[model samples]
Target: MKRFFTALALIPSAAFAHVGDHSHVAATHLLTEPDHLGVIGVVIVIALGAWLWRRGRS
Candidate 1:
């Protein structure tokens, strides 16, 4: 579980690579870039699924 969260924590690093280039419009860049958008989308889906699974378990 610790390793899972560690991996998730680092997943956003890919999106940060362009931070300096789009400081003024990072939000826009994140929305427009397919790679970045996909990363965020996948993360959100995974997190939501995990939450639902854990809730069901309890």
Candidate 2:
């Protein structure tokens, strides 16, 4: 659907938006790394899928 595509399109921008010189012991690796970004993509997809699933149930 159009809404799904819209959310997909926004994923990359939203992923990078979290990067703003914030230091953390939790995530030692840099966010700009390809592997880190890929992990973020997977997490985003999972989160979006969960959200859509819950929304549809309600």
Candidate 3:
């Protein structure tokens, strides 16, 4: 069970490299559109909050 959790945790880092291409392209599309920046800001805030919440729990 411990090893299973360990592998599961490592899988994200390995998998993340392939996932960002689409988002990167989308970000480029929004580069000239200031209106969408707010959405990006919200996502950043949520991500930071989740990261901090997990760290605090740990």
Candidate 4:
């Protein structure tokens, strides 16, 4: 019974062990998709604008 509980406790961790396996797939999609590129560009522009705004304020 103790061993059974220990195995059950480890079941969730074992299920999560593959979580990092798909990072490259996300990177590949981001690099290859024009929509993602546009989103990234917009984010970069916003970040740069904020930085410039802060710099001017100081």
Candidate 5:
């Protein structure tokens, strides 16, 4: 049982092992582009609106 748990813990690390091995082109663009900034701003506005609405309900 102990060995099984240990192997299970390693599964996620092994699954992501190739994540750092390549350049992620989309991720780079998402962070640096002005066009994507509008999307980020919308997300922030929605999140804040949801939080305020919940606060008002409580």
Candidate 6:
């Protein structure tokens, strides 16, 4: 959990790039947009649940 939060805090630092005179958007959008960030959060929760399920099965 600590590592996950740390990565989230640092990801924005590398999501940007300058293109000619404009800023290119890709990963940065995920951090900047609420809807996109929400989707990511949902995915993370689903993934964590799956991991726990598999571990319990074993």
| Leading candidate by lDDT | 1
Cα lDDT for residue 54, candidate 4 = 72
Between candidates 1 and 6, the one scoring higher on TM-score is: 1
Give the alpha-carbon lDDT of every model: 0.76, 0.68, 0.55, 0.59, 0.58, 0.62
Candidate 6: clashing pairs of residues: none
Q: Which residue pairs overlap in candidate 5's backbone?
A: none
* Alpha-carbon TM-score of each model against the true structure: 0.64, 0.49, 0.47, 0.54, 0.49, 0.53
Please list the residue runs of candidate 6 whose C-alpha ends up more than 4 Å from where it truly belongs after superposition: 1-24
lDDT of 5 by residue, 1-58 (tens): 4664566566453334333433546677656755456656755775687678779999
The Cα error of candidate 4 at residue 6, in Å, is: 42
Q: After superposition, how far is residue 11 of candidate 3 from its true place, in Å?
A: 26
* lDDT per residue (tens digit) for residues 1-58 in model 6: 5665666666653234322322565777658776656657766885698679779999
| Candidate 1 least-lDDT 10 residues | 14-23
Q: Which residue segments of model 5 deviate by more than 4 Å? A: 1-26
Structure candidate 3, residue pairs in collision: none
Q: In angstroms, how far off is 29's CA in candidate 5?
A: 1.9
Q: Whole-model lDDT, candidate 3?
A: 0.55
Q: Score residue 25 of candidate 4 by CA lDDT.
A: 75
Best by the TM-score measure: 1
Query: How far off is residue 28 in model 4, in Å?
Result: 1.9
Mark the 10 consecutive residues where model 6 has the least summed lDDT.
13-22
Q: What shift in Å separates residue 45 of candidate 5 from its native position after superposition? A: 0.6
Worst 10 residues of 4 by lDDT: 13-22
Across 1-58, the per-residue lDDT of candidate 2 in tens digits comes to: 5676677677675456455555543554656667677777887887788789879999
Off by over 4 Å in 3: 1-29
After TM-score superposition, what is the CA distance of residue 55 in candidate 5 from its true location, in Å?
1.1
**Candidate 5 at residue 4, lDDT?**
45
